[model samples]
Target: MPQRTNNGFGLVRRGLAPALALAFTLALALMFMAESAQAASLSSSRADRRAARNEAKTQAEEVPLTPETFSHKLVLDGQAGSVLSFTLPEAVHKGLELTTFQDLCVFDADGTPVPFQLRAPQGTNQRLEVEKELPYFMWQPEKPGAGTPGTMDIEINAKGGIVRIKGQTDDLAKPGPVSYLLDMQAFFDAASSPVSRGGLAFADDDLRERAIKVLLAGDEPFMVSVTMKTSADLDSWTSIGRPQMLVRTRQGDVTLERDTLVLPGTAKRYLLLQFADSDVPIFSFAARAVFDKTTHEVRETIVPGTLSENKRQIGYTLPGRFPVTAIGFDLAQAEMMAVRLSGADDPEKPYAQRASGFIYRLERDGVTVTGEPFPVTQSNRYWRLSAAGDIPFAAAPGMRVYWQPRELLFLARGKGPWTLAFGRQTAVQASALPMLGQSDVQTAREIASPPTDTGATTPAVAKKEESREWVLWAVLILAVVFLSGVTVWLVRSMKK
Candidate 1:
């Protein structure tokens, strides 16, 4: 009976090992399932947010600014020293934050540009009492200000400059009361004789600034009036500026100068030039088409360079793959040069001339400007330049990159609450107007819980997600192997 009891106890002990191993394996499987479900939940949330952002981006609305869309046009009587206040409508106040004075335009009744200084937005104003309001024109009589009471129009337009491309042209022969300065100078020998009159038509109506290049011969001094006109169709003409007088006379034997035309900033397809009857022969007339410069946030990047065997070739590797706009060089020696860009890591690859152009350097009046700023067509990680001379290593060379940021402003037409979504290129979930203000704009460490998880996920979050999946699988696999070994041991012990 005692022997039988001992055998029974041994059997029980042998069975206990397998039972505990099976129990341990079951717990590991359950934990893995829980972890897998959690990972899936996070992934699903990310996908939903990404899909939402894509849908929102596809349906963005754009509003074209025109006179027809103005909510109100205020016409006010103006004088030289008049103190005018403009009270912004409720819509403008709620939508925009007036950060600078470059957000408005003032014009006169005759469509002439009226220049006025933006009165600083003050905290205390007894006049209009509007919280987000600014004092209107601080008029000056000498400039583009109203000398007397007249009609004034205000509009919402940002202050920006027009791109002016100037070139000299000798193509000034027309059926007008004008003769070339060369002809007049040869005939009369009067160094002061200006070109009688001339007319040259622009290829397009976008002309912003026009100037006649004047080259004076000898110490001849004379005054001449210049008249300009514009025609949209080349048939009908409208006078640009009243005949303005220009004088050219000095002790120097020769002089080269430019007389700019004060034309209004408007579009005109054809331009006519009339020179005041002086004996001075005109050199050339230059006209620049006015194009509004696009304002963008610029970022600068530095790239180190290595001089090649020939020493004239400088090779560099760009740090990032960002689209490059301009390549800058801090030259120890200034020389005329051109740059070639490529993506090849090989040093032997010959330079291509796909986007190559002349580099310019000018130093006058103690100011020096040198650069070759060109738009990039394709992205390249490598760059080589064959300068007129060898690029000195001591001079630091770099690259200026302009990134087209992945951001945009959308104006939704419909009333009430609006939502936005974007970004499938990454784990970041989505975006919206109001949600962006809280999550993106406000730098709070903790975001107001994302609406539907549209915002993007950080790289750290994504890495942890991947690690969790691997860890869960690893635990399950290890539990299975351990349990199988324990079962084998228990069976062997029971048989013994």
Candidate 2:
């Protein structure tokens, strides 16, 4: 009976082997199912992302001027003082080129339009790893001042028994208004010597009033003309000058100050006394000058140029397709010349006349006193000397183009691959292609993940999902193996 019972137990244990084996196999199958499902889901998600990115690229509207199919060059004489112009072909805007590239060409000997390759300005194209958006303001059309920012005039009334002198002060900056009281009774007592009383100090001997200033009260308009002298050491004095003030107004408007006597020398501190033909009581008066507040913000950017010392002419070219509203040079001396911009749309009628006037700088006693600011306006390219003359170019004459850059629009079409072609013509062509596919994408800053409603998948999210799948597969594999080993051991023990 005992042997029979043992055989029954053995039989039962033997049956358990197949059952355990089946269980192990089923566990493996389930793991495989999990892996398959994860893979399918990942693949579907990736496909959706790709489709969305492609669609966004197709609809991308804000594209910069592609250098590959747009830019061109012309052959014209960049004479020192002769007008040159190049008009763009109207055919460029006929197609979707404006949204892609604009075609520009120059005429050959037979007036046949010959297209030239595009060359981008050096260091113009760049891609950063982080997203960058800069905010800038556009300039509204500003009406310039009628004359200058600030004006000063001296008026003398000798016939009215009282010398009534008046002044208008628009310049309220430092070195502005300096007032002094001149007692006529004390002038006679000094016996033609230096007087220093009542905020007024000056030498009466050989003393020429370098400048006379008048103060304007509320609604009291006055204009005065007075000879002024300026001295650095109070021993040497020079005459005031009638030169243009090369400076902007307080509102940041650039214009020339005309018919004004500029102070001599660079002395911040000086003394002033009025010069009168008669014993007139020039008792109390004030003076002032204006400085631009915009100088600190809208500073000048010097365009690249090459100067020839032999020819005394500066060869300069404004880089890129960006238009400049104002084009001028930093002048070292007073000069007179003309400027021109060249175009090629109409070969017979090709140049726009810009300036045919004097560029003046004020100097007193061979020292820089003051000057007029450069005129600012016009959107032009290929500007050169419009008149015919050989003015010696100053050493290191900086050619600067002042322009308020237009604000740009960058469409956030998710992040993947983007291609940008710039630099020399050949390089641009080699890297250029129709805006399609993931073949050549620029390394721009990773765009932020779109809103959840857009059903967008960011790179970060995809990587995280893959990691979770790997972890789940590993955990399931280890659990199955562990359970299978335990089942096998328990069955063997039952058989024993």
Candidate number with greatest lDDT: 1
Model 2, backbone clash pairs (residues 3+ apart or across chains), number: 33
**Candidate 2 lDDT over residue span 82-141, tens digit each:** 111222222121211121133232232333322232222111211111111111111111
In Å, residue 66's CA in model 2 sits off its true spot by 10
lDDT of 1 by residue, 60-131 (tens): 213222212222222333223322233222222222211221222333333332333322122221111001
TM-score of 1: 0.27
What's the C-alpha lDDT at position 47 in model 1? 77
Q: Which ranges of candidate 2 are over 4 A from the true structure?
A: 1-300, 304-315, 333-349, 365-378, 387-396, 416-496
TM-score, each model? 0.27, 0.25
At residue 6, candidate 1 shows an lDDT of 56
